[model samples]
Target: MGWIAVLVMVSVAIALIAFRVLRRKGRDDGDHGASSVDFSANLALAVYLLVLAYAAVLCRDGLSVSEADVQAEAESLTEMYWSVAPIPEAMPVRSQIRQYTAQSIDLDWPLMAGREMSPIPGQTLADMRATVLGLRPVGEESKNLQQDTLDRISEVSHARIVRSDDASTGLESTFVILMIISGLLVIALPWTLGVRPTRSSIIADLVRVGVVVIGVCFIILISHPFSGLGAVEPDAFKAAQRQYDQIDGRFPAQP
Candidate 1:
């Protein structure tokens, strides 16, 4: 994603020089054509920036929600692990919890790039619920603990749904198209004005092109929260691994 800006700038520079070489006789550098083009071009630039800003805000909010979802799920997993610890029949459930976390961090997280997720963690969670359901509690306290465990499982499931939504979220293609068209218009309008393209004017146009490239690339990078630069990582799950270690007092990574 970072390379996108660099590539755009290089390509624009080459194209600009080529167009300059093929230039014909220019019209008089009069005030009328320059002012009209300049005004329209400025408006184009402003519209382009506003669209990028809106897209950026959308992506940023998605990223924040994704991070929060991950944190919530990890915390739920940790709580569920502790909830199942006291039930003798639920020992296997602890292992299942660990497996789900492992699959989520290692398998599901990567698949989020394609707006997909692995079924392994989901299946593991279902199995854990079944295991807890089959448990027989003795006292009211044990029943309460069992209910707490089930509630944590539900919380984790809800968090997963939110995370999945975030993974699929991104800027709309229409916005991308609009941004590209407007940005190109900004770069090309001055040329269409027939004002003489002097060395200084050409240099200024190149700088404008650079700004457009940067804006376009920045928006593309921020289009999604699950991939590319500044993506929402599985750091929360990594922390959950440590939490599990503390909960189990040294449980291994795998079942």
Candidate 2:
């Protein structure tokens, strides 16, 4: 992005200027504390890169779990819809399933950017389960069917709760601060290497600072599960809706 390029350029410029000022002020005492600075900077860079890798993994795991939860929820809805196709009286139940999915995709999905979901869709799912519980089936097969539908609804309810929790899953603020500190130390401490600031040395320092910026930016960009371009979408729910239509067209619920 343009913003990213601008930030990297600005950061490199500021770092270079700061170090050049230090050099002009005769701050570099030939190898006076070079070993200590070298050790500290190396340690800081190691910690920074390690934490960056961990944050990347955390973001990846959160997105993967959220995606799996969504697919499971959609699967439960499709299975529930199929289970109730034989009973004409369960028309309302089927309709409620569709309603819940629609509300989730349309209303709740948008709210996920803020790590939230509307209660309306969840309530609709609960009501569907209650309606199934109220059914008085005569035959053993009918009783089994009712139980199956209830189980499917329960699965959907569980998956929805998990998905909501997953929405809030991301890197913690404290961890981000730690990353920033370590990254800056890596950029700043290397100036104590006690070497004269030639053009090539300054350029090498600039490259090091640039790498730090890129790493930090990557972590920040991917730190959230529900926001950003790599966000988990409702594609699973959309596929479930398509499957519902296919099932309905084939079974053709009779009156």
Candidate 3:
């Protein structure tokens, strides 16, 4: 943040100094093809703004999808945990569910920020599925419950994969580099019109640069799913853990 502030100040100082030097030398006589300069500046500004807008949309969509995936996984785990109660051999399965949720909240959440997935949760979930399949359902209702439990497990798997994928999702590096270059160019365009270094002109230039800095910075901050000020939280996983606590405490006899 300090460096960013310094950079902004330095860029503004340079632009102001250049404007003053050009004006003193009578180089900004407004006679060097004003129309052509206006056309090029306008075109650059248009393209820069369009790219920024597109990047903003992508960030928004990624955030929304990631949030939804978290909720979906949590809900599916809750359902699967509940669905196991009807089977006689489901106590171990219930324990597995609890372990998976605990590991996800305690281990997976932090690892996800670095795009690293903890294998324990996946392995526990797979074991839970195998254990569920091994349960011998003697009645139709028990069979149906088993099927539902399997379906919920499937949902949990899908949601978990999606959450992992989104953990590292963001604007591509190429696009980010392009955005930075274009943002700088956008701020530089005003000076190209040979505008005089009057107080009003300098203030306008400063304001334009400040606005671009804020916008570009904002987009970059939110682009990553697990980093920066706008990064997504593990609220859904936390809620799942809380639910597990409630359920696990209720069944003190089961371990």
Best-performing candidate as measured by TM-score: 1
Q: Is candidate 2 or 3 superior in lDDT?
A: 2
Q: For residues 66-119, could you state the per-residue lDDT of candidate 1 as single tens digits?
A: 788889999999888888776666768888888999999889989998888898
> Number of clashing residue pairs in every model?
0, 0, 0
Single out the weakest 10-residue window by summed lDDT for candidate 2.
Answer: 20-29
Number of the top-ranking candidate, with lDDT as the measure: 2
Write down the RMSD of all candidates, one decimal each.
3.3, 3.1, 3.6
The superposed Cα distance between candidate 3 and the true structure at residue 60, in angstroms, equals 0.7
Give per-residue CA lDDT, model 3, range 113-212, as digits (tens): 7767799899998998999899888799889999999999999988888988988677776766676677677677666755566767667767767867
| Candidate 1, pairs of clashing residues | none
Model 3 deviation from native, Cα RMSD in Å: 3.6
Question: In candidate 1, what residue range of length 10 has the lowest lDDT sum?
Answer: 246-255
Instruction: Sort by lDDT, best first.
Output: 2, 1, 3
Worst ten in a row by lDDT for model 3:
246-255
> Which runs of model 2 end up more than 4 angstroms from their true locations?
1-20, 23-30, 192-198
Residue-level lDDT for 95 in candidate 3 = 82
